[model samples]
Target: MKKIAYLLSVMFLFSAFAPAAMAKGVKKEKTELTAEQLVRVGEIESRVAEIKSMDFSEMSKAEKNSVKTELKEMNKEARALNNGVYLSVGAIIVILLIVILLT
Candidate 1:
């Protein structure tokens, strides 16, 4: 009974994580800077640095608020463009737990 339960739980864990870890024996391709995206991200980063270096004391409150909003929008855009694979820390911990339990 315990063996059956363990097998079922392990199978469940594998099924849950299988999709993201599907390329088990496959070679992964490089996922960076292969297009105009690098140039755009570079431009955004440069603009952000320029804004950061500016004297905020010389600016009005409204101007500062606008700059903050612009930075937030740029951050959102960068995140949208950054469609990288995300590994879940919780999932990793759970997988480790399962492995320990199994052994």
Candidate 2:
């Protein structure tokens, strides 16, 4: 009887604490982009799409190289603009894992 009671109490305590621990592990926030950033991202995406739609076979060597460089630069810019959210989500996942492990 005593063992059963102790086991039940322990289970109850775990159930109560588990949710609080998980809650602490997560934080939600809204991300908003400024009008200018939105416009710039849209423009970059459209330009990349335009580049992709071009006929590379008809282009000369120099034109191909220029297109490649331009695409690389635009990709870098897009990554820079979006990396913050990705990094933060990665951090949050790491933190949650740590919390779960510790608990």
Candidate 3:
């Protein structure tokens, strides 16, 4: 029937838009680290170990705090970058469609 067809179209449109709308609202927690960041962290840890071996008291509190802050920001940026690189919206939609079909 015409009404049934119209209803189906409306439902289809709603389903298509709903996921995107929800995805936009949902914030992915940024936590993924990049290779560069991993390297930097390793370097920092190595430096810290070297400093400790030489003299743990040599590093001022301010210097240690600055390193910690830099590492934390690097980690956060790495996470945001990861979300951009992986989990693309199109991929998510395709996966969603596949799952829906499977169900």
Candidate 4:
């Protein structure tokens, strides 16, 4: 049992460290918004609000479809402009556990 456990731990450690040793450093993406980007984001928000306020019931099928496509494109652009790190519940819990264990 002792020999088996020892071998397993050694295998785990080797597998873990090997990836870190072989992997190249990755370039991080830009997270902060510039002045122009901030202004664009504001414009996107106002446009979305304006679209929401309009009467969709009166529009034709083709007009509604066009509006839908435009909104999707604007949403994608807004998300791209608002680039930032987002940690999930599981990630936060794991980080907390790691911190507690280390301390």
* Model 4 weakest lDDT span, ten residues long: 94-103
Q: How far is candidate 4 from the true structure (C-alpha RMSD, Å)?
A: 7.5
lDDT score, residue 55, model 1?
99
Ranking by lDDT: 1, 2, 4, 3
User: In model 4, which residue pairs have backbone atoms overlapping below 3 Å?
Assistant: none
Q: TM-score for all predictions? A: 0.51, 0.52, 0.30, 0.53
Model 1 agreement with the true structure over 1-103: per-residue lDDT tens digits: 9999799878988798797598677866766765799888999999999998999999999999999999999997888788666568997888788887788
Top candidate on TM-score is 4
Tell me the spans in candidate 1 whose CA falls farther than 4 Å from its real position: 1-30, 84-103
lDDT of each: 0.86, 0.79, 0.67, 0.77
Candidate 2, residues 2-72, lDDT tens digits: the string is: 67765665676678569879898687664677799899999998998899899999999999999999999
Candidate ordering by TM-score (highest first)? 4, 2, 1, 3
Model 4 reaches what TM-score against the true structure? 0.53
